[model samples]
Target chain A: MKETKKILLNSRPEGRPGDSNFKFETEQVSEPKEGEVLLKTEYVSVDPYLRGRMSDAKSYIPPFEVGKPISSLMVAEVLESKSDKLQKGDHVVGMLDWKERQVASAEELRKVDEDKAPLSAYLGILGMTGLTAYLGLTEIGKPKKGETMVVSGAAGAVGSTVGQIGKILGLKVIGIAGTDEKVEMIKNEFGFDEGINYNTTDNMTEAINKACPDGIDVYFDNVGGEISEAILFNINKFSRTVVCGAISVYNETSLPKSISVQPFLIKKSSMMQGFVISDYSDRHSEGVQQLAKWLQEGKLTYTETVREGFENIPQAFLDLFDGKNKGKMVVKV
Target chain B: MKETKKILLNSRPEGRPGDSNFKFETEQVSEPKEGEVLLKTEYVSVDPYLRGRMSDAKSYIPPFEVGKPISSLMVAEVLESKSDKLQKGDHVVGMLDWKERQVASAEELRKVDEDKAPLSAYLGILGMTGLTAYLGLTEIGKPKKGETMVVSGAAGAVGSTVGQIGKILGLKVIGIAGTDEKVEMIKNEFGFDEGINYNTTDNMTEAINKACPDGIDVYFDNVGGEISEAILFNINKFSRTVVCGAISVYNETSLPKSISVQPFLIKKSSMMQGFVISDYSDRHSEGVQQLAKWLQEGKLTYTETVREGFENIPQAFLDLFDGKNKGKMVVKV
Candidate 1:
């Protein structure tokens, strides 16, 4: 038997998750079963949606149970294998529990070629978040050349990719974030046309109008609530609004008060659509390949706020809600 | 000169338009120029959107000038013609002033044949409001068979047509209205599967759930305040929300405080599209013809809430916000 360190869920938190929500436990890892492979976790991806899974609320995805190790998109190396599909020393990315070592059935993992990109890239830009941004902008947003696109939570993982992709499609990308630093980073480094710091801006509608002078044609919304309502006021006729996430109002015990945008929809003759990445599972490979090509062509860039050790996974996720991470927040377990 | 009684703008009201906002004045008809025709107004259509036009705010259409005769979709008789296309005694429907008789350019009016449907039906079911409901549903809403479809302001002109069309497409049509009488009318007369009166219902969510057991697939929203929010809570996966009008919130000085529905869009992977009738101006005839075919086949049914005389046009328009009229509210001038 080999020793495996696991981060188990101790209890659910009231609002923002804390260290007490998780406990570091040591367990014995046995040999792989007939069709299973043993993987040693290398990197764990922390996302905003994980907070929803922590609670018992009914979401698109199921909730995580108490006393169980939190599962996330992880990059790992095979330590032992009995399955023909994977061999020892193969690096892969799959939905896996937070553990130093664990045995999973062959059906649970997909082998990744290390030569294509960095192993950690599989957990960020070239992974689910990146794919989500790509497909959402192309498939639903339908961004066109010289159009104005406004994205909320623009400094975060998915929002950053969405802004880059909007620029690639020849759209003027305007981003909205919490802090001035993050806003500057999104505009200067991420190649966004402009960035609006929500904290400093008293009138969001005026800020959005100033940023998007031509009126918003495509709105890639991640952080919903007041920001979304503001964007609605400046949308051009026949605008497309992609509802990717609503991190701003997700943790509220009761529904948060928001300005109604429904009337604005009629005024602008616009559209607001909601989407989850899983809905595009069939086109996952297409998104991944396109994003991978963009990365290789130097047309796209990504940033990760990496935390060391498996014990920091909970904190990394908490940092996402705090708007502390500039991009994808990941843990090197 | 021929004498005619016309409805003129008396003054703009501060809240909820009233009869005081209009004044009936007698005017002598002016003779048509070289390329114009004298039109005898038979049916002056009173639509909810006309209320928007009375204000000075920037909108898709320009606001009506104060102290001037209100302009709208009117069915008329060509008493005399100076254009090659039109003749004396020809029935027509066009954008015209609300006078009993007026001179219109030949280019502004389209001939309406009484043989196709009732001449008044051309003003209600085969007119702009009817086309708006038909095209908005088909082009934007895209209601599918067996899907649960919900329409707000379900007793109004567009709402009634939307519900009937939803039923024809094999949809389980659910309607939301302000009063029990309107709710009963929608269910009994318009063929809606169920109706929810928002005024009487304690729990709107529960009422929506009961009405739409499978959840709402298509929500054709005409009223956009609290009713729109209630429907948003019950929308199913991949739902399509077509925003036609927000009659409920149109008169409000400020946007309503409500819960944002952007997260639900992500959960359901849904889309909300706003549309105006003019966007499909090129296909107006196509919509009108399709609606006429359905009406002739006895597959679609419509009702008209007719207010007699041109003097009552302003009151009829105001009656829309009060939910006083069922079906299309038109003034027989």
Candidate 2:
């Protein structure tokens, strides 16, 4: 094909990103150069943390340049190769372009085993998402057996995985999500002990207190808003809070306001820490090995909300902020 | 003496505490009972943490009951010993009443050496203040040599000690205090690299950025409010913050407001944890030994603002919130 389509960050949005902020364009490309493989994109991962990269502000990750193809984690297949490390028909994953087909360097791609797990598992459960849940929970959360663990954004990819790991670690896992559907999924599918739908709950503090009578010992905070305020009020003494993402406040045009957490933190002598998955880069293989073992042993489960085609990638990304996807939001290109 | 005068928590204050909230009462006692020793107060320690106990709110320590003598850490002389573990004329430190004389259990008092250091040094440098600074810095801050460590409330007992320990560990110490006098004391007496007077500076963020050009790596937070928010904004990526106390908010009747810190924490991937000195109770001897050795070797220097007589205890405690004392505030009886 002479034409290839890709999504570009046309402009940085002031608040929540829109379709206008993203510009889609087609370009002509020949084939893979020497030491590069022509990869056909199979799955594109849309993560909430990507919103941080959209702004020019300093963050753990660099900002995405305007008028360029937005790059993210994706699972692909080797269609053609000029590199000795990769062969045709091999499955792979890398920070490839949002376009359907692109030439990637051999070192940039990691070969994935399709027979051991489905190809999409490389983007959700057995990939960086799963590792993110594992490292943040075990390293920061440090949940003890029989401790109560509460996770916000419990229906999302990272939150859901964190809940599963919390259960396997023998914690009483409670999840906070936006919708009734998400609440049902968290309790039934994700195996959470209880779920509070923040959208319908009249009083979050009372609801949280009811769900977590023992008080929250380890709080995996994925959403930072009123829900977090409630969780802060309900933390047990010496509790630990692992701040993985703040999807609720990521698109706020103004400063997000809530009850100050310092007083509660001081009274309870608690801890709160934020980290990205890349901080655990050296332990990636270790995390992946453990996650895979859990998956193969039936101790871990995952869900992926897959949309069809490459053109829908931007919408999938935007839907994450709206809490539209139940689990990992991936696009089949 | 058959009668002893001591301070009492008359009632909970609305905002900042005053003399009316504290009551001076005289209590009658016969003599020392079995396993109890008579202790005459030499120096009664007044701390910022005492404000937490004055309120009915839940805290690390129980609130003082109305019409009861408020008890705290005090350096005393054993006047009459009924226990074999203690002897008359022995100087000791214990959680004793703020009075001229009292009876204490043998195990309640730890014999402090007046030969190694001054009688008052046991309440300031070689005591809980020093231990709080030691453990919170070494255990939580975990700062490296040449890293920038910013301490708020730098003129106070705990913060002054923290700054000194930071220097001993080869860190670039920057202190934030309320007055020009304190700023000078932090820089000159404590040997800090820089000091920012929060009282004089209109723009804290700008002032902090000017002082810590390399950005803050470790922050030992003794006062939390705008100062803490400013520090959070200027923290380098992967910084560590030790929340020892929040004196600034201790007097606020409403929720203290500043820019939300969650975004900054997330962007920098930083860590913040709060703690009480007693959290390291099991390792008290470890901290006391190091502090004593530091004092004996002349590696550590200290100052104490002493008020003579028992009736001045409430005023001395109130002065802590007003930032009147340069170092530890103690009542000498």
Candidate 3:
């Protein structure tokens, strides 16, 4: 038997989640049975979407129950393998429990090459984050060349990747971020044509109007609140809005109200669509292949805010709400 | 020279439009120039969408300029033709001004077949009203046969037509209207599966949940305010919302606020799209053909509240805001 540390939900969050919402415990792990592999967790991905799972609300995916082990995308090292598909010492990735070590079925994990890309990347740019930005932009945004594309939460994992992809597609990409530093980073490092520091701007509507003189043709919305309401005014005819994530209002205890989008949509003949990554599961392999190609060609780059030690996982997740991370926030075990 | 009465927009409405906003005057009708036809207006269609044009705010179509003739879909008889395309007494339909008699270029008008359908039908079921309902529902709603479709403003022209088309397409249809009488009319006359009088219902969200037991798969939203917000709670995964019109808030002087739709849309992975009829101009003929076929097969029917006299046009338009008419509201001069 091997000793492992695990984190379970102590209680559901009310408005914003904190350390009290999570309970840490040391547990004993059993040996792998036939068709199972013993995985030592190497990287734990902490994302904003996990906040939705913490609530007992009806969503695309089932909410995580209280007093149960939280699970998410993680990269692990196969310490012992009883399956023929994966041998000992192989690096794999899958939706696994928030534990230091655990036994999982071999079919649940996919092997990752150490020489191709870093292991943590499988949880970010090469995994769900990349797939989401790619599929959501292409399938819904339907971005045409020469059209202007605006991205909200522009310094984060999905937003940064989406803006880069927009540039690759020959679009005039603009980003809206929380800080001036992030605004500069997106323009200088991410190759975005323009950037708006939403925190410093007094009137977001006027700022967006000034930034996008020709009007926004496609909008990748990650923060949905007042910023989104402002973007509505700048949308061009037949513009498409990809409603990816709403980090801004996720912590609100009550229903948030904003200017009605119906009038703007009707006037401009636009479309606003939302999607979970699993909705495009059939085309996931195609998305990964394209992302891999871009990474290999040096056309794609990613940033990671890695917090060391297994004990820091809960803090890492809480940090997302405070805008503490620049890109993908992950915990190294 | 011929004398004709014309109605001009005197001032833009502050909130709800009133008769005082319109001005009527006698003018001399000009003779037909080369390629022009002298048209004697017969049937005038007054719609809720006209309220949008009365404001100076930018919209899908240019706002009706104050102190200029207010124009809409009208059926007219050609008194004289200077073009080879039309003959005298040919009944035609087009976007014509509010004048008893006027001269228009023949190319701007399409001759309506009085023998196939009544001349007035050219302004309702076989015209923009029918086209708006059919195209908006199919193009955006994308209703599957077994799906449940909930329509707001279900007793109005586009909503009634949308609900019937939903039934013809094999969808379970539910409608929400203001009055109990209108609700009964939609169920009995329009053949909706269920009806909800929003004014009488205390909890619209619960009402919609009970009406759409399987949850709403397609929403034909004609009135976009609290009713549309209530529908957001009961939407199933991958549903589509066709934002056809927002008569409820069109006359509001300031921006209307409602519950933010982004969260609901994201949780359900649905789509909310708005469109103008002209966006599908390429498919206009196809829509008219299909609507005509459905009407001739007795698979479809229509209702019209025809108000008589040339002077009552402005009053007829004002009555739309009070929900005084059922289905199409037309003025016969």
Ten residues in sequence with the least summed lDDT for candidate 2 chain B: B255-264
TM-score of chain B of each: 0.96, 0.98, 0.99
lDDT tens digits by residue: candidate 3, B130-236 = 99999999999998899999999999988999999999999999999999999999999999999999999999999999999999999999989999999999999
On DockQ, the leading prediction is 3
Model 1 DockQ class: high
What is the per-residue lDDT of model 1 for residues A200-314, given as tens digits with 9 covering 90 to 100? 9999999899988899999998988888888878999889988989899877878777887777777778888887888889999988899999999999999888899876777
Best by TM-score: 3
Off by over 4 Å in 1: none
What is the C-alpha lDDT profile of model 1 across B1-333, one tens digit per residue? 489988887877665787888888898889988889999889888878888887887788888888898998889999999999899999988899989889999898889889878888888889877898899989988877889899988988889999999888899998888888888999899999888889899989888988778889999988887887888778888899998887776777766777777877887888887789888899998998899999999988888888897767777888878777888888887
Instruction: Specify the highest-lDDT model's number.
Output: 3
Better of 1 and 3 by TM-score: 3
Fraction of the native A-B contacts that model 3 recovers: 0.94
> Residue A316 in candidate 1 has what lDDT?
81
* Local accuracy of candidate 3 as per-residue lDDT tens digits, A99-156: 9999999999999998999999999999999999999999999999999999999999
Worst 10 residues of 3 chain A by lDDT: A58-67
Fraction of the real A/B interface contacts present in each candidate?
0.91, 0.63, 0.94
